[model samples]
Target: MGPSVAKLASHDRVWQSIRQSAAAMVAEEPILASLVHASVLNQLHFEDALNYILAQCLGTAEAPAILLHQSFDELTTAHPDVGAAARADLAAVCERDPACRSPLEALLFFKGYHAIQTYRLAHALLNKGRRPLALHLQNRMALTFGVDINPAARLGRGIMIDHGTGVVIGETAVVEDGVSILQGVTLGGTGKDEGDRHPKIRRGVMIGAGACILGNIEIGARAKIGAGSVVLQNIPPGCTAAGVPARIIGRCANTEPARDMDQGFDDVEA
Candidate 1:
């Protein structure tokens, strides 16, 4: 059919599958029945359930859960693309992460998913000139999920931040679509120099855990960054880099390393 119709069909399928998974969870582990129902089964729309979950997770004594729930609902209703990007992100996790068996798991359990969706909302707010509120969201996400992504950062759709703890993305960093970033990864600047001082990650790149990619470098498309590497300069497309001061170690076996989710640091040639 048409694009809108196809999108609706896809959205329907994703929501239905997540609902079935949540139901199965309730039946199998009766202990989590309340949580499953509240998080997934109770809501009519997928976005509503997501908003409720985010509100509950981000709420505190000062800002009540009910108010935050209303606020998030308004935000997503005003800007539906945030929810759409969230669905794409959920699909990315399901397709790339072996541990993510169902969309229900990514929706209700994964903090990486939670952090990304929250950043999307905060980014939208930042664009709308709600700086204080956006910063509040950024602070909450950092404290609660241990994932600190600046709201000003430009992140494209279909991103999967696996095991999201200790991940820090700088304010000027730009992460393109279909990128997979592991835990403890830092996309920070090298020095105190202001204005556009962060890495620009291209599409389908996979950055391993604890990889510190510092400075205003261009990480080319489908690049594979080895774990714990200290990258200082630009990397060409389809290449792998790894070391204390990471150099071009080799070329990747897989064309789409992010989608492939391969963590192998092989030796071939750039």
Candidate 2:
């Protein structure tokens, strides 16, 4: 199978849960019933519903909603992995964010989830040599969500970007699976660079809000970065870095900082 076959088996359970949640929301807030139906219930499949929702959100006069919707549907049809990644991301949000009430809330209302999903779509298109369209989607996403992630950047599944506003990931940045990044974070470059300039974020890393990790550095796996710090050097695995020009304050209290979502720096030395 090329990329069109439905990956229903993998997403079935979550899709059903999301549908139930959406229906519950409609019942609770009767005013939003029509929107909830159009966003989830009316669609034939999960991917179809997602495509329609994002297209309506990012579509503009230059990029009509119908056209954008069809293109996103085609992308998902050609890439079942895209749908799979989106499912993982949705779950990541629901699991990690306390404020996230339901999977339907993550699917319909969260800009962080929306940005990541759209970035996945753009990344898939970029790999197919559709640079122009990929760039266009990235531009629209940045403008709409205040999160700017280049299409060329490589990101893995189960990414949770909490309060995604002002999240800027550079072109060559690489974020591995199960990474939780907060608002105002910047995975960027420090100086004039050519190729592979951005930071390489390892798996299970939790970067706090407004932390800037600049240059071609590697943030080791399961490391936690404190809020508002500037990460200039390579951080070791299972460590916690904080302060301006972040220092290794101490080891992560637990191995899975990303999954734990713990901001308690009580054990770490300032």
Candidate 2 clashes between residue pairs 3 or more apart in a chain or in different chains: 3-77, 3-78
Q: Residues 1-270, candidate 2, lDDT per residue (tens digit)? A: 112323442357777777778778888999999999888877767788889989988999988989999999999999999999998998899899999988889889999999999999999999999999999999999998889999999999999999999999999999999999999999999999899899999999999999999999999999999999999999999899999979999888788899888876875533
Model 2 weakest 10-residue run by lDDT = 1-10
Each prediction's total of clashing residue pairs, residues at least 3 apart in sequence or on different chains, is 0, 2
Error of 1 at 193 (Å): 1.0
State TM-scores per candidate: 0.94, 0.94
In the range 1-270, model 1's lDDT, one tens digit per residue, is 245534553678888777778889999999999999888877767898899998899888887789878878888999999899999999999999999888899999999999999899899889999899889989999998999999999999999999899999999999999999999999999999999999999999999999999999999999999999999999999999999999997898789899988888653454
Model 2 CA lDDT for position 201 = 99
For all candidates in order, the CA lDDT equals 0.91, 0.91
